[model samples]
Target: MADISLLYPKGKEVSTMTLTEESINDLSVDYIVESLTKDIYEKNSIKKILTNLTCDIDVINYRADVFEDILNFPELRDGLVELLKKLEDLRELEKFNKDGDASSLWQLINRLREIDGYVLCITMLKNILNTIPIKSQGLLDLKQTIEDIYNNGGFDILKKDIDETMAKAQNLKSVTIGVNLDSVLKPKNAGVISLNNFEITNSGILKNFMGFTGSKEELNSDEKVLSSHKLHPANPSLTRMKFGSAQQGANTNVHIDTSGSATGDDPLSQSLKKVVTDILKRMVKSIKATLQKYVNISGYSLVGLMPEIIFYIRFAELVDKMKEKNLPVCKPLAVPDDRVAYGEDIYNIKLAIKRTKGEEFDIIGNDITFDDEQRIYVMTGPNRGGKTTFTQAVGHCFLLAQAGIYVPATKFNYSPVDNIYTHFPADENDTVDLGRLGEESKRLSDIFKVATDKSLLLLNESLATTNVAEGVFIAKDVIKAMAYLGVRSVFNTHMHELAHHLDEYNSDDSYRSKVQSLVTGMKDGHRSFKCEIAPPQGVSYAKDIAEKYGVTYDQIKKNIDNR
Candidate 1:
C-alpha cells in the first residue's frame, strides 16, 4: 500500500495524457527520444514516457523540480542510481518467480527475498535522505515514506527475523513421496515418506555403477548385469534436471515453467511437485507469519518507478552532454495562463544533437512568441530556408517544456497546452486514394476535432501539395478556424497568398485568435534562415537567384552581344 510516484504529486497519481501517433512522428519525437536514450538502460520504457505527455499543472511542476534536483545534484543522482540497482535486483527476483505457480515454500522464499530487497532499499533511502538535500517533492516524499514504512511498519522486526525464516525455508529441499492407491490401483491419497537431504538417484543404468568400474572377475561374477542408458552421465548433482521453474530462458533447464500442461511424465520430479506443494503449504504458513506483515509493500511497486527514474537520468545525461558542448539548455518556466508561448534563441534540438557528434554546421537559432496578436502564423520562406526546421523547433520547445525537461533554448516561458497537434505534410503516395489535398484536409479536420483553445498546433506546409490557388483557399479557412478556436498555431507554407492575407482573419471580431505572417528572411541574396514576425516576404527567389547568377534576360543578352 505504499503510494509513491515520480510523475505525480502526493494526492494526484492516477492520470495520463497521450499524443496522437501523427503528432509523435510530426514532431520527430522518436528521433529525439532515441538521441536521449541511446545506449541507456530501459530505453523503450523511457521512450513510452517521452511520447506520452502529461499536461497536469501540478504533475508537470512536480516533475520539473524532480528533474532539476537530478540535474543539479549529482550526489542525489548517484544515490538514486544505487537505488535503481537495488530495484533491478528486485525485478530479477520477480522475473524469476513470475514464470511458475508458486507453492507455499517458494512463495515464502519469494517473500523473504522481497523483505531483503526492501531492507536494502530502505537503508539506501535512509542514506540518500540523510546525505543529500533532495529538493523535489517527489524524491523527498519517496525517501520519507520509505523511512516511515520502516520505522512504524514493524519492518525492524522483519529484518531481525529474515535470516532465520530464509534458512528454515531452504531446508525443505527434497521430499520423499509415497503414493497410496485405492483397490482399483489408482492414486487415492499420497503422503511424504520422508524429507531427505539427498534424492535417491534411480536412472535406468545407475542401480549399480560398481560393475562397470570393477575388476574383470567382479564383472564376470555379475554376468547377468546389463547396461541400460549411458553411464549415468557425469555427476548426479550436475546431471539432475531443473524442476518447478528455475529457468535460463532459452533452455528447458531454465527456471521458467515451459511445461504448459501440469500432467508431465516425470512421476518423481515433475508430477510430485504439485502434491508436495499442497501437502506442505499449510505447514509453512506459521513460519512465514512474521514476514507477511510487510509483504503488502511489494518490491514490484518500487520496480514500477524504474521507467520514471530512467527518464530523468537519461535526460539529465543528455543535458550534461549538451552543457559540455556549450549549448544553452534552460529549465522552462511553466506558465499556467493561456494563449502564450515565448522562446528566445531556440534552435532545432535535432541540430544541437548533431553538433555533439563532431559535425560542423551553423545552426540558425530563431525567436518566436504566440499571443492574442499572433496566435496563428502563416509562414512563407525560400526552399530549404529552414521553414520546416524552425516550425519543428517551436513544437519541440513546447513539448520538452511541457514534459518538464530542459529545452534547447536560452530561455523559454510557456503555459501548458492540453496537447500539441501537428499536421506536417504526409507522404504524397499515402494520399493516392483520398488524393493528397483531400487526405490532408481530412487530417487537418481530425486535428480540429480534439484541439482546444489552449492547444499548440504546428502545421508544416499544409495544403501546398496542389495548385497555389486551391491550397491557399483551404489554408485560409484553416487559419480562420484556428482563430475561432483561439488555438496557437505555426502554419508554414509556400503559398504566398496564404501568408498574404492575415488581417482578414483578425478583422473578424468573432475569431479571438489573430493570424499573422512570418517569414524566413534573405540577406545578401542568400537564405538567412532567420524567422521573424512580418508580412509575407513571399519567396520571389526565382528572380533574385536568376539575377544573381546572371541568368536574367538583360545580363544574358549583354553576354551574347559581347561574345
Candidate 2:
C-alpha cells in the first residue's frame, strides 16, 4: 500500500530545469567577452582583455580536466597557454621603453620578461613537485610536513633564511685564505682538538709517523697523527702533536693538535660546517622567496589583463571557425562625423530608425540640433511608415555612441541625454488588465517620476486605442507637461487635426519656439523621406494607410476605376 500524501508532499510537485555546467560555462564566457568589449574597446587596452580571456580559459580548462580526470588533454591546455603567451607578448610590447618609438617595444619586452620569468619558474616548480611519488607512511609524513609548514608560518622562516644567505654569499666573494678543518672531536683527555693545518690532496697524505695507505685515499700522515692526539690523555703534558706536510716547502702543511680544555666541546670544523650549511640554506630560501614574490606581483598584474585576453582568444577562435566554414565575417562600418556631431547637438531625436523588413531604411535629414533651446519635437506620421522603429533607432544610436560603439547613420549630432525613456510595442500578455492605454499611462508616469531636464522621452502611438480627441488631448498635455518640466520629448502620432491644433498653439509667440513638427513622408513610392520644422503641407496619409490595411492597393485601384 502507498500513501498518496507522502508520495507527493505539499499537494503538488513542480520540476524545475537548470542550466548544465557546460551551458553555464559557455554563457559565462560570452558574458565576459561582451562585457570586456563594451568596456575596453575604445580604451586601447587590448592586452588587458587578452590576459583576462586567457586566465578564464585556463581556469575553465583546468576545471573540466579535473572533474573528468583526463590528463591526456594536452592540446586543450596547450592551445590556451599559447593564446596566453601571445597576449603576454603583446602586453610586454606596451611597457618596453621610455622613448617614444623605442618605448613601445621596450614596454612589450619588459612585460614579456616579467611574465616569462615568473610563469616559467612557478610552473617548473609545480611540475617537479607533482612528479614525486611516495606510498603509505612516507606519503603521509610528507603531506603532514607540508601542511604543517604551510599552515604554521613556515614561509617567514624561509624568507629570513633566504635574505641572510644572499647577503652572506655577497660578502664571501671578497674574502680568501680561510682555515680548513676536518671532523671536530671532543675527549676527556684533550678537551677540544681543532683539526686545522691539514691539507687534503689527490695522491694521499705525506704526514709524519702514522701514515695509512689504501687503494683509495684515506687518512693522510698528518691527519692520522692529529686523530691519535685527540684520543690521547688530555693532561697539559700532551700539549702539542705534529704530522708531516704533503707539500715539502709549505710550512703550514704540518698538522697541530691542541688540548685547550677551556674551549669546551665546540670544534672549529663543526662551527665552520654550521656556517657553510646555514649559508647554503639561506641561498635556497632566498631563491624561493624571490620566486614567491614574483608570483604575487605577476598574479595581481595579470588580473587586470584577464578580460581582454579572454575576449580576444574567443574572438580569434570564432573568426577561425568562421573562416574554416568559408562564411562571411561581419565588420562594423566607419561611423560618420555628421552623426557624431548631430549626436552632440540634439536633445531629442527627430526621426531615427534602422533598416526594417520591407522598408527602405535611410535616416531623414533635419537640422535637429537641440542645445538648451527647442527641446521638444512632436511628429505626426502615417501608420506603418515607421514611427516606433525610428524612435527605437534613435535611442539605440545614442546608447551605442555613448558606449563607444559605431552609430548607424552617415552623421549624428546630438546632446548627451541623461536618460532615454521608451514606450513602444510591449508584450500584451504581460500588461495589466487595465488595458494597453492604462499600462502606457503607468509607464509614462514612471518615466516622469525619474526623468530630469536632461532626459529624453520617446512616445510611439501612446494612446492610439482611445478616442482620437482624447488621445490628442492626452498627447498635447503630455508634451506641454514635458515642456514645462524642461524635458525633451519625441511624440509620434497620426492625429492630423492635432497638427492643426499645434499650429494654432504655436501661433502664440511664447509656444511657437517650444513646439515644432517634423512630418514623415506620405504614401510615396520613392522610399525616401525629408524632415523640416514647418506646418505640415499636402494631404494626410491616414486614410491611405487605413485603406492599405483594410484592402490591397490593387483592389482599391480597381474599386476606384469601377466607381
Q: Rate the local accuracy (lDDT) of all candidates.
A: 0.74, 0.41
Cα error of candidate 1 at position 375, Å: 0.7
- Candidate 1: tens digits of C-alpha lDDT, residues 209-288: 33433566653344122221111111223224442222101101102121112223342334445555555655567566
- Between which residue pairs do clashes occur in model 1? 245-255, 246-254, 246-255, 247-254, 247-255, 247-256, 248-254
User: lDDT per residue, candidate 2, 1-563, as tens digits?
Assistant: 01111111222342212222222232232332343345453223432322221112222222222212112233433443454564454344334333353322122224334444334433432343245432223223333433443345644554454445334333322111122222332212211222223333324334321243333365444544334222223323212323232221111222211110111122332222232333234444544544454343342243343333343334444334433433322222222212122432121122221121123433443334443345666676655555555555555444433322234444554444455666654468856686776776777777788776656667776777547777777767777667666666667776655556654544445432356676766544332344456555435354455555656567778889999
Model 2: weakest 10-residue lDDT segment is 1-10
Clashes of each: 7, 47
TM-scores of all candidate predictions against the true structure: 0.82, 0.41
How close to the true structure is residue 436 of candidate 1, measured as C-alpha lDDT?
A: 87
